[model samples]
Target: MPSPAAPAHPAHLSPALTLLLATATGLAVASIYYVQPLLGLLSAQFGVGSASIGLLPTLTQLGYAAAILLLSPLGDRFDRRRIILWKAAALVAALAFAAWAPGFGALCVASVAIGLMATLAQDLVPAAATLAPEAERGKRVGQVMTGLLLGILLSRVAAGSLAAVAGWRAVYGSAAVAVAALMPLLWWRLPRFVPATQAGYGELLASMGRLWLQHAPLRRAAMAQGLLSVAFSAFWSTLALVLAGPDFGQGSAVAGAFGLAGAAGALAAPLAGGMADRRGPQAVIRVAALLVFLSFAVQAVAPASLWLLVAVAVVFDLGVQAALVSHQSVVYSLDPASRSRLNAVLVSGMFVGMASGAALGSSLLAAFGWRAVPVLGAVAALGAVVVSRHGRRA
Candidate 1:
């Protein structure tokens, strides 16, 4: 029998290619988060209650979760380059629709579409893993993850600042233009990926369930990371509301500026990746989760103190980003041939937690007030620590 066909177009990851992957991942994922800082503004403009406006991010994250489960696995069955380009075009359209949305209902529809298309970011990540040599996989994944983390953190800053000056619509318009410009560059640069499997789409998706069951580590990583995401998402989704309330008397710009505090988390990504490579991801996960728990616990005590909140943001953001990088390293190592499907399983869990957190954060904020938000985050993060430790013992 013929030797199994070598995975097609296998090439070492060049510096230029790494940079492209990182930039592409950042831009794509950023699209999902641009509405976060603008939630307060959106609530006011739409004349809706806090819980209702919170549904926007919840819908976007739910869309992302749906796409990760439904679309990301296709990378293993098709040329990732083709998938990226097609998704990029669709993402541009979605962003444009969001910008031109004439009503709150239209914007909600656009948010879901944007989340679905932004799974291109998920594609770029596994592509990075596929390109890198095994020894360098963790570090390279970390570098790409750094871009993803920065995109998430900085998008809030850009959206809030731009929304303050030009209105929220301008933020979406500019993002659409950015994604459009990115397409030609991606077309010119990204190499064609050899499809990893010829399995039909149904089989490909079914494989994800098998992978989840076959790999205990994958499940644990997904669970811990998912819990951490609850803390991270809850904090960000509710932050603007907390700042805008009578206690702080701030606006979107100030809310956006908080992203700068979390910039420290961006810097921590590569370090976390390297640490996972050196010490293993389990220790990293436990320590990182504890850090998140502690940071949020402190924030719960002094929720109204701006300076304390800034410090809490820096520490917790660092912990959350570190845990994510470590989790990716764990999942990517499990099944090389099924990297895309494995990632789909891992990130699907994460976005589910994000959707839950956004909804829960908004409800908690509305019912009990801002003080309750941090407590929810603290509880979720502590649960991550317990899960990580339980995985180790098992």
Candidate 2:
């Protein structure tokens, strides 16, 4: 039997198709984040404690994590296009349901459903990787990732603006309408591809464990990105509190506006992809590590001017996102048949890192001060640099 890792040179994906895939991925993934900026409004409307309302985003993350582990591997055992379409449909329904949900309990259920189906982004990413030639694989994945990043950064903007104008529920309603409209475009444009693996569902899932134990490159890529994610999460998680301190005396709105600066950094995704193609993904990761380290180092030295902090957000996102694209490029190259499962493992690790970083960042900020937060970020990025360097030598 021929190896699945051997290049097939898939020629069906056109530029138009690629754009649609990227857009679809961006829109699908945005659903999980829309609630973050509306938590206070949700608490007021639902007559709930702010602490209880926090469960909306928490459950969404939990659902997304579970879906990545459970549903993502199905792409290898079935048709990826079908998986994407089915999940997109579920996502549309979930969004609409959340919009109309009568109470907190119903909204919580809908939020989980939305998260579970948001794996559509995960499915599209691996599909893009599989469709591109080995030489251009990083570039293609980067294109899709750029959209994914834009969606994450912009979702807060859209949600906050819409909530101000209409109300919190209107945000979800608008998203549902947009997603419903996107379904036909996806159905019309998506290219279908058959899976090579004939393994039963149970066996397919079991193989994920074997793949983890078997591939050194996969493990390295996951570890490197996971560490970088810790730094990324640490910054964003405590940013609002830091801004609210006496020196800054800003509010969450100011913190939210900083996402626009971060969006500027996502533009590097395609460029990083192209570099990974030419110089190898490891080289891109090396540059990314250095950029992340420098971003924090500057923050530690320079006092926190708002403009300076904006620049820091841009630089920090640029480095972390570049490393992410480079890491995915390496993981996708490991096995053609297992790209989706590989992504599941790699992304799962990132989530774990983000959760840990959020908790640690919060603790550090409370115990010490805003000054302590950057030191934690710098140390985490330094850890990422060490891991990437070791991976390079390996």
Candidate 3:
């Protein structure tokens, strides 16, 4: 199975294949996030404070960032389907270790491994782009991204609800089972993708730096996504703390329920893709940035209202998802041969920003409470807008 007989480059993805990629991307990405809403429960179980537990999400994202840099580029040098299958197997093992970790240190290490293996989704994204027609590329990427975002949002809900009934470890256990189940589906349906580059591992890694230096539009797209990621991470990373605090006194389930609100953002993705197709990605990105910036301000207006907070979640998610699709549309069109490496460079920045945001959001919530989160997130969203504006001029 290591070197299966396959075409140099398979035919374009059928709609069924496209749907498989979207579902696979979603499931794979979800592995890195199942612990989010479970953060409160894990904190109590591990005897850690809110601020300290932030390392869990931060380290997970850092691990993901590292995978994007180190592993995602390998897709361009090897068969992508093989990469996805082997990574999924590794992810199953990582999830099981996380479910059975005996201490905080063990759990933290497992979390990092889980995140690293979750880069299978990164592999699939570019593979999808490679299999689509240029005219349909944006739409296809948008659909895949919608699945990815839904996985992230729904993961919280599933983890929280499962933890409420079965315990924190149960969430990870279920995740392991889900990934194992997905393996057979992918093994049967996923098509092989030949390497576009004959570069060795060393050269593949080196080219990412060169790609960054060579492409200005790539730089703009990456910077904008990174800044927006800071805001997105800020909200999700801190929401559990805020809900469990004195005002709400709710458990993890409440945090998970809020994910439903954010799911509204998924609706904006197809629209953003179509808009990017019609008016250009930059135009769509501009609107996305403004929406995110405004969501933060609206959040500040009703800091203590739960229903209003839910509405803010919806608006913010919409903005973030829209910008993400637009950004991918821009960069994916830059170089088809470099799609995996390009996406690796782009999303790697976003994860770094996510890690930073998680750490920053935790500190702010621990110190000043909920009010500070929106303030900081707004600043980050506005930074994205500035980057987009600059990109327009350049």
Candidate 4:
């Protein structure tokens, strides 16, 4: 059963609040990804082996998965505004710590903290759903998610360009400053959220397990999205390494520019959301997964061609992101009051897949070659397609 409904809220979210939510989500989530484009530079600076450098992203994703499971559900039991504020402050500090870390080990520790605090972005998504009217929920969530997807894509571009000019430390330092500035603005403009449930923390968590078992749609959404995330993470976590190899001999700046190709994919979020609102998310999932599989398959065969890789990136990123919006639409509709916990379960699965992909992709890239990375992605995308095909309808 749906937990007691949240106190009735406004039927529509204002434009200004929507933009604030989007901006906040984007900036918060960007912290986890800023290191990706800089992996090669970090490898050289920290004197770590290429394969070991992959551990940074792996640890970050692991930390994120842990936090999503542990902390994200707190939004339902407490005022989401308070949770967002507290996490934002910690995120700022973590980013600063990462900027000044004197060694790779310290940097890795800081990366975990960055991931933990970045759950603020996840908080904002449920908050958006809580605020928007039922009729507009899909569109509103899509808008905020567009900010999130852009932040994930553009952070690479920004980090690469900034690191190229001022060095990697400056990239983290600038992120710290940007997030710090946003906090006061968020505080000033964001409204307080009424706690959706009065359950104690332990009961609240227990309820999540009940929710998972109670809804087949929730389980399917999590499984399909998690599988898609494996492909998404594998491609991104290894792209810099691929570009740095003799096949391309490109630098971080060039690898970061490839984020531009992925940015094109962000356009799919609102489109997918609108489509889901009209036609339902299931069809969208099937088509989007196919796009991802095809994109990765092509890249696996022609890994050496930069132009082909860029084109494939655009297609696969679009597929991955579109599927995410559709999955969220399905999950959010599961239980109105349980949106936070449901989101936690869904996104936790995604980051687990991310952690796995980073670990697996790095190992494959090291053992086999760049071709192997996309092959892994192709296989994972195919699995997602299979899951969508076999699963119960959302």
Candidate 5:
């Protein structure tokens, strides 16, 4: 058989294909996170605690993990367009359920459903890379990645503002409408390729065990990204709590502004993509860890300083986004045929990392208070930097 084609340079992609995937990524990835900024409102409507409101993201993440672990292999076994289409439809249903949810219990169920359905993005990214000309895979993937980052960072601000005005259900309802409208277009526009494996779900999941044993890079990327995510989670998950507290005593609108100001973080995608294109992904991780460490350190000093928070947000976002993009770039290089499964491993690990960090930050605040939280995050990134320097963190 002919050898598989080599991956291409960023400049190799046609602008049209890159733009299409980027647009689709913005729409699809946003669906997965529309609930993040709405958690406060959802909690009020259902009457839950911070830790319980925490479960909104936690359960959604768990559902995402399950989909990646269980469903992503189908991309290798079946037609990807159909999988994307079906998952989008399922997502619409889930979002609708969330919109009309009557109580906390129903909301949790809907969030899980949405999380499971939204893993279509896992399949979508692999499909984008697979369809790209080999030479431009990184560039093309970077374009889509910009959309992913934008959706992730902006959704908090966007959803928060919209949630305040129209209510959380309205925010989800609007997304559901957009997702439902886009499904047919996606089903039509996506490219086609033959499936690589027809393994059953059990067999596909078993492949992950083998994957874990064989790929050192995959494991390392997961660790590096996971730690970086924990650092990020430390800030985002508690920003509202701190802002809403006595010192700042700010409202959600103020808290949401941080998300917008932090948009600078997404700017690093191109830089990270370029770095991975040149020096190799390890270099990107090293720099990202250092930046993340600085971001946390800056926050430690800037307790009531908006300007300082903004500066740190920029640094922190750059570190997190760069590390994230670089991590995905590495994983894409490893296995072209089963990226969804690989994504399942990587994305789920990231959420768990964030969840762990968020939990840790909350507990620290409860005991040592908010002043101590940034120090913990700084220590996390610094620790990663040390580990990376030794060639162990990856």
Candidate 6:
């Protein structure tokens, strides 16, 4: 019998179909990130402090953690398509609530719900991993990952750009329709996976702990990605502030343009994934770390130049997406029996890092100034780089 990881490609599925689904995945997940770039505007409109506005993002992160904590393990228990459909349903509801949200408090409540619902992507991933053909899993997964990363990067602009034209509420309202439209396509196109009927939730939770304890690669990847996520989050969390400064004094639309800049790096995600397939994830991680260090170094020194910032954005994004794909490629390979739980653990760590980074960036901006925050960011990026090397060596 041929092994699951054998050399033959799974071209049974159409590339166009796969790419379409992957792009849909990215679009859906991007909903979670739409608010980050708009926090400043939200703060201004809601008459809240920056920290209070920050709650918009904080709640989303926690909600993601909570959803993954509870729902991801279900991937092992039932059809992943069910999980995806249900998640898409909830996302539409969440977007509706966010659209109609009356105040900061209401928006925060809606944000949490959105985050929780958006985590359906976490469940969706194991499904994507399973659908990927054996020999080209990394490349296939990478193609899916491109959409995920695009969702993350592009949604930033979506929020800002939308807010610039209509109101802040309209942006979220539009996401409602987008998510709703996706449900049918996914329902029709996604393949089915037979879930384990044997394991209970308690058993799954226990296994999550064991997965964390027993697998060095999972643990290392989680920590490294978590830290890098914090760095990435910090940059994004304060992007509006930087652009709104005297140097550029840009509006939300102009600020959103930076998302286009970050697209350069997002475009690199599939390349990194394919490379990981050929060279092994360790090499990919090592190379990604170098890119991160270079990007951060540039950010720290060239605070005044928009073109420099744009170039650095590409490098930073490249490092982040490359590192993430590398980690996912490795972790998804562990314990086919519990890939969902593994993803939950790995993604939850990123939530922790994201919340921490947003808070850290906000605090530093309030105290030491925006210029100083990227110094710490550069340090964080370097720290992640070193950690990645140690993980690779060990």
Better of 1 and 6 by lDDT: 1
lDDT accuracy of residue 340 in candidate 5: 70
Clashes of each: 0, 0, 0, 0, 6, 1
Model 3, range 310-329, lDDT digits (tens) per residue? Answer: 88888888888889888988
- Candidate 3: the clashing residue pairs are none
Q: Rate the local accuracy (lDDT) of all candidates.
A: 0.87, 0.78, 0.86, 0.87, 0.74, 0.78
lDDT of 4 by residue, 269-331 (tens): 558878877878898998899999999898877637889988988998889888988898889
Candidate maximizing lDDT: 1
The segments of candidate 2 whose C-alpha lies over 4 angstroms from its true place after superposition are 1-11, 14-16, 39-58, 100-109, 128-142, 238-253, 277-280, 297-302, 359-375
Lowest summed lDDT across 10 adjacent residues in model 4 is found at 1-10
Using lDDT as the measure, name the better of candidate 4 and candidate 5: 4
Q: Give the Cα-based TM-score of candidate 3 against the true structure.
A: 0.93
Deviating ranges (above 4 Å) for candidate 1 = 1-14, 132-141
Report the C-alpha displacement of residue 363, candidate 5, in angstroms: 4.2
Stretches of candidate 4 above 4 Å error? 1-13, 132-140, 277-279, 392-394
* Structural similarity to truth (TM-score) of each candidate: 0.93, 0.82, 0.93, 0.93, 0.87, 0.89
Clashing pairs in 6: 26-147
Tens-digit lDDT string for candidate 6 (106-206): 88899889988888667655566676777876567667766787788788788888899897789888999888887777666666666766688899889
| Candidate with better lDDT, 1 vs 2 | 1
Tell me the TM-score of model 5: 0.87
Better of 3 and 6 by TM-score: 3
